[model samples]
Target: MLITDDDEGDRRLVARALKEGHLSCECVEATSIEEAIFACSEYAFDCAIIDYRLPGRDGLDGIASLHQRFPYMSIIMATGQGDANVATEAMKLGASDYIAKAQITGGSIRRIIENALEKAAMRRKLALQQEELENFAAVLVHDLKAPITSVRAFAVLMEHSVGAEITDKDKLIGQCRRVANAARRMDDLIDTVREYTRADGQLLSGPVEMDRVIEDTLSNLHQMLLLRGARVTHGRLPFVLGNASQLAQLLQNLVGNGIKYCEAAIPTVHVEANPDENGAWVFAVKDNGIGISEGYYQQVFQPFKRLHDKSKYEGTGLGLATCKKIVERHGGRIWCASADNQGTTFFFELPACPAIA
Candidate 1:
């Protein structure tokens, strides 16, 4: 907590009130707005109380400056006289709350501080949600353009050759196939987007059997596995509390990625789980395929983020992003460890189901 008051008496009074209130905080004193800004740069303070009168600038100016720099910090304006105009302007300048000097008792101060902190937390959460929505919009616009453009171009070409006596039948057939493939890509992207959004919905949680999830996942990807000549093996897995379908989708995406990115004649993937020290189930999906570089580990989980060219590997690029959302929804976390040219191991931790009595 920071206390900014040019008057030494007022500063000491605020500190004493905090102590009397039994509020456990490391209070930092600043005599001016400049000092308060400097103190903030030096230490990460959660809340600040600024006197209406300062040396060079008033409390409203200080509130605007500090809010601009650290938008997440909670700020309270303190004034000797309760001027409604000043209070309204301070709020517009991002002051979380306003308090009069007469009400500087331990109880009132504590209540004001708590309310400011809660308001600040809500503002931060809303900011983060807005940022995520913007990113989602940008990804959709950038990724969907390519397939849509391809479909349009191919359709135009086929239309141009519609009435012309086609000398080459194979060429027209190839154009038709291209149009079909582009349409399929667009359909796949839309389906993945739906799955990604659905992961955020309320989970119908239960004791999901890992063995059954893996079995169903493999069955769903049987044709892809056969075509790629990939092998997926797993040990005796454990039961975890999560949504059954989502768990299946999570495993399917990981295993499919392992097979899709491999260059080996016969790709291989292994899934296993063990109990961690915290009694949670730590699961790993190890793959013997072309691996990811250390630097791109974090970026790979972002939506529509890809490391390879579309011609070489085909995907909507939402697989890992969807997996991350699913794991997080289940109150878990997922990450990967790998090196270039070496194999990769993806690890996720989930709560272990209690033993049946």
Candidate 2:
């Protein structure tokens, strides 16, 4: 916490009150708003208390400046008695709460500080959710445009061919197939969006044997593997605490991408896991395929962010994003390492399952 009051006596009084309240907080003092802003830049303080009267600027100015720079920090304005209007203005300037200097007490200050912190946390969470919703909406609209247009164009062509007496059977049939494929692509995109949304939900947690996850994933991709002549091999894997179905999806996506993006005659992918120094299981899915550039390492994990043209590689581009969400939900992280023309390896770490009693 930070206290900004030009009056040394008032600063000491607030500090003393906090001490008397037995609050577990480290207080930093600043004589002016400038000093307070400097202190905040140096460290991350959860809350700040600013006196209404300052050297050159009032607390409202400080509140506005601090709030603009650090929206996540909780700010409280301290005003003199009968400063109700000032308090209201302070709040409009982004002050979380206001306290009258004369009313400052151990109990009152503690309650006010607690409320401010809670409000700050709630504000941050709401902001993040709003950003996510906006991003999802943008991605959906942008990606659906091409497929939707294709469906409409092909449907029109098929309709005209059916009306023509001299229509070629093969041409009409090809148009109908094009329409069906476009519709299928649209359906696939919607399904991918649904899966991505579900990845953000509560995980149904349990011990998941990674070997079985690989078995199921490979089974799911059996046809793709045979068609591409891809080879997938894995060593013994450890058990992890996560959703079994999501883990399987994660691996399936990685393995499928390895085969889909390869230039090799026979793509090869290997999956393995080992214990890290942090007591987490680090799993790696390595592939021998046309590799990713260093520049696209982070971009690959963003939804609807495609590194290749859809004409060459068909996908909604949400696979790696879904993988990232699944790993994060399991209290882990995922990243990749690759060089151009060299194979890529995706590594994710999840909490190891606890030993049974």
Clashing pairs in 1: none
> Every model's Cα RMSD, please?
2.2, 3.3
Tens digit of lDDT per residue, candidate 2, span 262-287? 99999999998988899998999999
Candidate 1 lDDT over residue span 1-357, tens digit each: 999998889988899999888899999999999999999999999999999999888889999999999999999999998999999999999999999998899998889999999999999989987998899889888888888899899888888787676668788899999989988988999999999999989899878889999999999999999999899999999889889999999999999999988888999999999988987899999998899999999999998888999999999889999999999888889999999878899999888887620
User: What overall lDDT goes with each candidate model?
Assistant: 0.92, 0.91
- After the best TM-score superposition of candidate 2, give how far the Cα of residue 74 lies from its true spot, in angstroms: 2.0
Poorest stretch of ten by lDDT in candidate 2: 158-167
- State the local distance difference test value for candidate 1: 0.92
Assess the local accuracy of residue 123 in candidate 1 as a C-alpha lDDT between 0 and 100. 99
Error of 2 at 204 (Å): 1.5
What TM-score would each prediction reach against the true structure?
0.92, 0.86
